[model samples]
Target: MIKKFLVFSALLCSAVFCNAQNAQLEAAVGKLTRLMVTPDSLGLDSILLDNLSYGHSNGGLQSKPQFMRSLLTGASDFVEIDLTDKQVVIQNKIALVRHTLSAKTNDKNIPGKVKLYILLVWSNEKTGWKLLARQAVKVPEK
Candidate 1:
């Protein structure tokens, strides 16, 4: 009976811990999105990993420095970003997040709206959760 009780207690604690971690990760993702739209270099630098791989719907990829430069220089300007249907799965120190992104973008001085299916990979590092990789595919209009 004691063994069973201990096992159950451990499981409960683990579940609670996972829930808390999930909440923290979700908040971090939201903050990163806001920083991306507003182009906060400091926040971006903090939230992104040094070897970030950011992939766009057009099959373009950018390294951490390139991504930051694009956003800072208005090469890929986001006027608004809305995320929906977000799902996060955590395993050990890695998290896989999937979401639908709807945004108004002003890229190269041209304004347009975009809907994309996005996948983001986050790693729980010593500092906190940092975005390690991301890929987005454009959603077709029906």
Candidate 2:
């Protein structure tokens, strides 16, 4: 009886821990999207790793500095964003996040809408969870 009880307790603890980790990762993802739409340099910098690989749907890849510059200069202006079907998987200090992103943009004063499958890699450090890498692929129109 005691063995079974201990086993149940362990399982329960693990489940709770997993839920908590997911919540944290989700919150971090939400913050990232919000910052993208608003273009908060300091806020975005706080959550991004120093060496970030940011890949776009156009087969273009950017470093952290380049990404920041584009966002700050209204070159990649995201007017609104919506994320759906988000999934987060964590292993040790790293996490893989996947979601469908639909956004309205005004890039270089050109209005557009985009739907993308986004994959974000996050690394948990002493400070908290930070974005390590991100890649986006264009989703086919229906």
Candidate 3:
């Protein structure tokens, strides 16, 4: 029937839309990682929401300005960052992403490595996807 055909088409369209949104979110995350490692101030400012809440495993939290300052001032220097096992779910204008982050950093010139489970919340804006929040928990060594 026409009704059934219409229903099928609607479902197919929704699935395709979701796939495209997921790809966009993944690309946003990738760009964020690159910007973090390289400390691109302009790129960072564009990609992060003004009210960003960035939480670390040590129970520390930073606002958007603080986070940007840390990167700009060499307080947080990432030599390399690798993200794995990423899963992204999109709901309306928000996307939730979970991933494993393994990174080498030089914080205040003290070199260190970290492995953490990260959760990132992105808000889809008119310009693009902006990082709204992020939390990281240390992953135990196996």
Indicate the residue-level lDDT of 4 in model 3: 100
Residue pairs with clashing backbones, model 3: none
lDDT of 2: 0.93
TM-score sort, best first: 1, 3, 2
Error of 2 at 129 (Å): 1.3
Write out the backbone clash pairs for model 2.
none
lDDT of 1 by residue, 11-116 (tens): 9999999988998898889888998799878999999999999999999999999999999999999999999999889999999999999999999999999999
Superposition error at 10 for model 1 (Å): 0.5
Report the poorest 10 consecutive residues by lDDT, candidate 3.
18-27
The C-alpha RMSD in Å for every predicted model, in order, reads: 1.1, 1.2, 1.2
What lDDT does candidate 2 reach at residue 113? 95
Q: Candidate 3 residues 33-139, lDDT tens each?
A: 99889887899999999999999999999999999999989898999999999888888999999999999999999999999999999999998899999999999
The 10-residue segment of model 1 with minimum total lDDT is: 31-40
lDDT of each: 0.94, 0.93, 0.94
lDDT value, residue 123 of candidate 2: 97
Off by over 4 Å in 1: none
- Model 3 earns a TM-score of 0.94
